[model samples]
Target chain A: MNHRIGWLIAGLVLALAGASQFLLNDYYQRVLSVIAINIILAVSLNLTNGISGDFSLGHAAFMAIGAYTSAVLTLPVRMKAIVLPDLPVWLGQLEVPFVFALVLGALLAALIAALVGTPVLRLRGHYLSVATLGLMVIVQVVALNWQPVTRGARGINGLPPFTTPLWAYGAMLLTVGIIWRVVHSPLGRAMIAVREDELGAACRGVRVFRTRLAAFIIGAAFASIAGGLWAHLITAITPASFSFLLTFNVVAMVVIGGMGSISGSVAGAVLLTLLPELLRRVETSLALGGQPLYGLSQVVIALLMLGVMIFRPGGLFGREELPAVLARFQRRRSAQRQAPHPSPSS
Target chain B: MFTPTYLAQQLINALNLGSLYALVAIGLTMVYGILRLINFAHGDMMTLGAYLALAGISALVLPAWAALVLPMLVIALVGVLIERLAYRPLRGAPEVAMLITSLAVSSLIQNGATMLLTAQPRPLRVPSALTQRIAFGDLSIAVMDLGIIALAAVLMVALGVFVKRTTIGIAMRACSENLRAAQLMGVDVNRVIVVAFAISAGLAGAAGVLWSSKFGLVDPFMGFVPGLKAFVAAVIGGIGSIPGAMLGGYLLGFAEVFFVAFAPPELSGYRDAFVFALLLIVLLVRPAGLLGRGEVNRA
Candidate 1:
């Protein structure tokens, strides 16, 4: 839990990621990258949706902005000219290093979040949710109709796959670290207070609006980074790739892991990412009336989520981190060992 | 460009569209009013209705009228079943948990449909009589459109009478106003909830059939967009108010039709975006909607 231990664990993770590049096969490496990106997305989304309780449904839009920005910026100039002929000359000609493009994309996403969050963060409950969903649809509409810049529905492809396990895992660590810091800071406590009771938080001198806006902007920035990583990992980008389904998947991760828990997000990201992959094999082998059982994984996952909601609505961790849970288990066990066994009462 | 005949034709189109939206939105508002839960699966219910109607006509060889009736009944039951199985247990849980559960239900239904039906678009065969057009001097309208409008109006009027005049309807209104007070007054909360879901799903079923007929296609995911738009309509009218939902639906339908009709052709693709923007604007200016009472946050 100390700073030194945190740095050591981060170093170990990066070293493992570096080792995976050499040890793991291409397919496994790709999966690892996807898992890392999903972790970044889930953790960032949890900052707003879970920790701050803002419940944004437009995370995908920010991701799309990041993806598109990074894709356009890093697309070889020749390819940009061919794919996006009508792009502004400055935009069409410019190409940046992968990290710089990703950063720029994140910044752009953060700027848009600030712009949209100003008015939108004023609303509460379902109204806020629908307003955010509207923002998502508007963003998608632009991406779809702005053919010159986005290449219409065809999307962009054949980009260099700059997202390795190292890059993805490193970014994931950074996102988790930043969010972890934010959640533990005074501002994070303010966010929690606002979430519990906006009026009460205001009465307690917490700047409710600023706290929420901060969470929203920071979450959007990290989501954009995840988007950029996703685009580069796949070496292809499409507007459709950043649709509600992606948001739903991320939301599922946050919910299943435990809302308001950082380690829960990591666990949820890993479990959900691997679940479908494992189910994909099951689906292929299963058949009904000689037809392959496609979409089975989705049905199962949805059912699992429903079951979780019904049985354990707090999710797997229920607002507790992995270490906290383990530590509690250890304490309980020690206490049990010290207690005298009771004989049957008369 | 603004000729009377063209305007009349557009008005008819708007009316037809508005009726469908109102039908869907009414159901959504009814559920939200009583439960305060945004049933994300409502749209999928519409899809299921369409598919059921398709099956009734094509697979069962039922007449078109029979097809519509059967689906409505079946979907009504399905709605009640879902309320009991999925929603009842989470009664006192957090709003977000219920929301997530609805999302899960929606995904389950959509994926289940996809798994069983193969996700392909199926054509819903309509009798030729409904497709025939009637002309009034300069303007012409399809019989199906007329039928849809009349059917929707009758259903709404029936619903109004049921809610205002009937004991159960009054019970529903009581529950929506204050569920705890209604229960304290000896209202059968379960019965009222079941009736609300049945009515909502039945309306959605009818709307689904009409919507699919209008578009001439049925698919697993077809209901999502219309369902979402209907929710917007419900919001615009002021959620939890029936008449408000109807009004909002008509307004949305008219806005959409006119926006496309008047805007440049290149701007047509952004019609959905325009609708959502209108939603955002409405939420900002009148969060309680045109008819909804302002929500008071009780400490």
Candidate 2:
């Protein structure tokens, strides 16, 4: 690893980023917060997609899982009390706070993943993709009909407000940090090996199912945290909000940032999140003739996804990072600063 | 709790829904078997087929036969065009790329329709001749629904004969079984794929008319749900199998309608839920789907 100075620099960059969110207005801050959540989603998705090479479109399904789980758990017993009038006074005032809800949301999503991923993971290619997609549709269908739990499609609104820019970015950083550790771990290496070639990976003694399952559940867990954060930040929840479009957006971000690169995921998330608002602003300032209109953001997103897929399947950064990347930089710096270190030592 | 009339009504609904699913799924299964890609834009193809049918019908009320025939022709051509323009170029690319491209094409079609044909929903015209209902005892079925069932059956038969007995059909089957082997045998693989798309589009075109007439409304986005279900049907039946696609569609339709009919009203909204839950269970139990051949178990 690089010396503490590189770590210090990374920390400083994140700190400066955190402090700037406070400077922005509340709405802008909230948008930035959403970006942070997407960062978690895109990066977590990369764990399965970029590194493991699975087109798991049902990722937003996990987001829905997280959101609904957190919504049920995090919404004050008081809010539920007034909404239901079921005579449980202690439950109404008993808010479980934001962080706890996020953890529960991640756990719920992971639990569902374990259940769904087991058999479905046996299928591969578009079969696996479609099956996972079916998993999502099933979850949505359950959420829509399980009125006692999810409030059906009328949606579960009025979640506690806990996702500020600081909290969201903080969660974002923690998610990225943890995922980075996971990816650098031995398990992450095996997952990548399977992705490169399943037959070869199996021959080399990798447990294909376990590796795939770990990636699947972990991705679900982080996605749920993002969902929890999103639920609270918006303070309003609906199945419609976490529809296929959300999935498309997150996939787009991961692709744009570079599939396997954590840095790329963050870049993609921030760019895509800020892009709609920026485009909406630009669309307002400019116009086709004089009529006020919107939703071209979808057009841009669709085009970008198509363009990226067609032009650059390897994504922006092309998957090479973290294996002596820090050491390479340190070697260069030490050579410059000390001026006596042997270049051959590397 | 089952009455003759109620059973009859559900059967008629199932037939109507099943035929539409058949139309959409046949094409899907053909491509899945041959190319091994799920054209996510397939739903949009159905939408495009309906719109084209609507456009043809809009100019002047043609006789029912002419209306159905001409629209199918137009949509079949459109399907071939899509293959040439989009699917062919991305032929050897990863399935994910093709999937995303299909999505792009889908958004392009929907929004393009919104821009060109007016964003508002339009009523699709059903010929008065075909709109009448035939009654048997207390049970009644619309002519359009009956016609759709009959037509789908005929097409399915015709398709089976064409694919099995004819030279092109045999070639298509050969290509689907082994692309490399068929290529070595001098089959024009590209031509076969285009034909597959054309057939798919034609089926969708026919289904489009029935779909619109039954629903009494037409919009650019109409294909989304049906397309999805047809894909589901394809998966259920077994991707790449013609009979599987049709059978899957009927099973799903019956399952959905039955759930809606029997389940509690609050749970009625779960018709799709039950359908998908059934799909997941199917995935767990029979990962190749009910009739699909299993391959690549460890991805």
Pick the lDDT winner. 1
lDDT of 1 by residue, B89-198 (tens): 99888787777888788888888988888888999879888899999997889999999999999999999999999999999999999899999999999999999999
What docking class should model 2 receive? acceptable
- Span of ten consecutive residues with least summed lDDT in model 1 chain B: B290-299
Clash-forming residue pairs, model 2 = A77-A91, A77-A92, A78-A92
Each model: TM-score of chain B? 0.98, 0.95
Q: lDDT of model 2 at residue B191?
A: 85
At residue A252, what lDDT does model 1 achieve? Answer: 90
Per-candidate Cα RMSD to the true structure, in Å, reads 2.2, 4.2
